[model samples]
Target: MIEIRNLTKSYGRKNALDGLTLSLGHGVTGLLGPNGAGKTTLLRCLATTLAYDSGRVEAFGLDPSQASQRTALRRRLGYLPQDPGSYPHFTAFDLVDYVAILKELTGREHRHREVRRVLAEVDLTDQARTKVRKLSGGMRQRLALAQALLGDPELLILDEPTVGLDPEQRMRFRALVSRLGESRTVILSTHQTEDVAALCERVVAMDRGRVVFDGTPGGLAATAAGQVWLSDKPPARSQLFWRTADGRYRTLGDRPPGAEPAEPGVEDGYLLLEVAA
Candidate 1:
């Protein structure tokens, strides 16, 4: 388990994370929020990639501030930074191999075996020898994922892992992560709400660098229970729609008091949560 107590990050007078605390148990937890909502900041602090001004962080039963403990924790965790870049002219295979050594996952032959395994897992075997600069944006992301899988980590922290993939590739990646979470912790920070509803058993929603909600998708949808309605037409004062074959406009909004409730969607639930904040 991962425990974050009284976590905080300050950039001079500005607060990136304010008194954040959370306990991460085993399973897939969607870190849901908009950009600059401290999702990356929190992930970076957990990965020990960046330092926090104040907080106590314990990961996999080790304190991240201690050198030995930090080393141990890193071995058990796989992190993919928001921006995964490498020096120009380095081939995908070459860079992955280098990361394997840095992780110290194995020696010569074993390292080669591990590198080849992850490269194939990320579907980059065909372009393993291709230079990063020459690869497409999606391919570079796959290479980054390859490196993250090098150590077969127990905890995987993925920030927007499917951003560049095509629909097919994204589905494949999501399936792989879902499988990985069965035995380990997979904390995924993403702006994609569909990904959360599909892959996460629970979600941590943040706003302005603070956790505004944490619960299951169903629970989140429940937030809009009485505040949603389906309208035959949009507000009369607003512009009219072209209508979709059916004459009724099928618009959605908060139902008026004493009126029947409308079925709420995840998007509607999310909007309600955001507005309430």
Candidate 2:
């Protein structure tokens, strides 16, 4: 549903997205990256909210750079930005209502119905009248998601949708996002490997504005299959090592002396990749 080719973007001299080429289809796809990996820049460019320096972006068979096409594309998509602004004075319902209007839902009754349905989908129905300032971080995140679900768009782009959410809330968010991706394309951008492992069938890892890896979650983990090990103490030769909850050291890289092989996870593969870069 989306095609990008050699997409390049920059902020002054530093490149945020450089020679990034990606294509996405139906179902959920996770975009994984570190702080400067350009995941957000890619999302903003794809959402038609930010212009790129060069290359092509086609969404739903239209070039987003063109005014008419971008508007048309936006109509068929929903976007939940990383920092979705909140109106302190507006209640949850009011905030979603405002977004519905922006989406061009003219009929009052129909718009209200859609808003209610979306709020329920995100489990924010109980907070419908709660002011934005009064809602907890998790509740506010759900409210942002509610607005994104207003039109039941075919393409959903969520940037860090689980941020500020507790474990229970994150689980709820995953369930809602997974359900939404059943028959549509969902591009989820986040730093959470567990979120991607749980919700995405395909995953892409990015670094320094470029695509580092793209494949199934299993494929990602496979990159570190023989490299992950566990030891009683931290591995001195390991590229990355951390003390586990059980007091053992889980290490990735060249296996250390007395270390036992451990099954690699998505995060393991990702860290190994970043370390290599």
Top TM-score prediction, candidate number: 2
Clash number for every model?
0, 0
TM-score of 2: 0.98
> Per-residue lDDT for 87-176 in model 2, tens only?
999999999999999999989999999999999988888989989999998899889988888789998989999999999888988898
| RMSD (Å) per prediction | 3.0, 0.9
Error of 1 at 139 (Å): 1.3
Q: Give the candidate number with the greatest lDDT.
A: 2
The superposed Cα distance between candidate 2 and the true structure at residue 64, in angstroms, equals: 0.8
lDDT per prediction?
0.82, 0.92
The segments of candidate 1 whose C-alpha lies over 4 angstroms from its true place after superposition are 236-253, 256-262
Q: Model 1 over residues 102-161: C-alpha lDDT tens digits?
A: 898558889989999999998888998888899888888888988888878998999888
Q: If candidate 1 were superposed on the true structure by all CA atoms, what would the RMSD be?
A: 3.0
In model 1, which range of ten residues has the least summed lDDT?
Answer: 235-244
Error of 2 at 11 (Å): 0.8
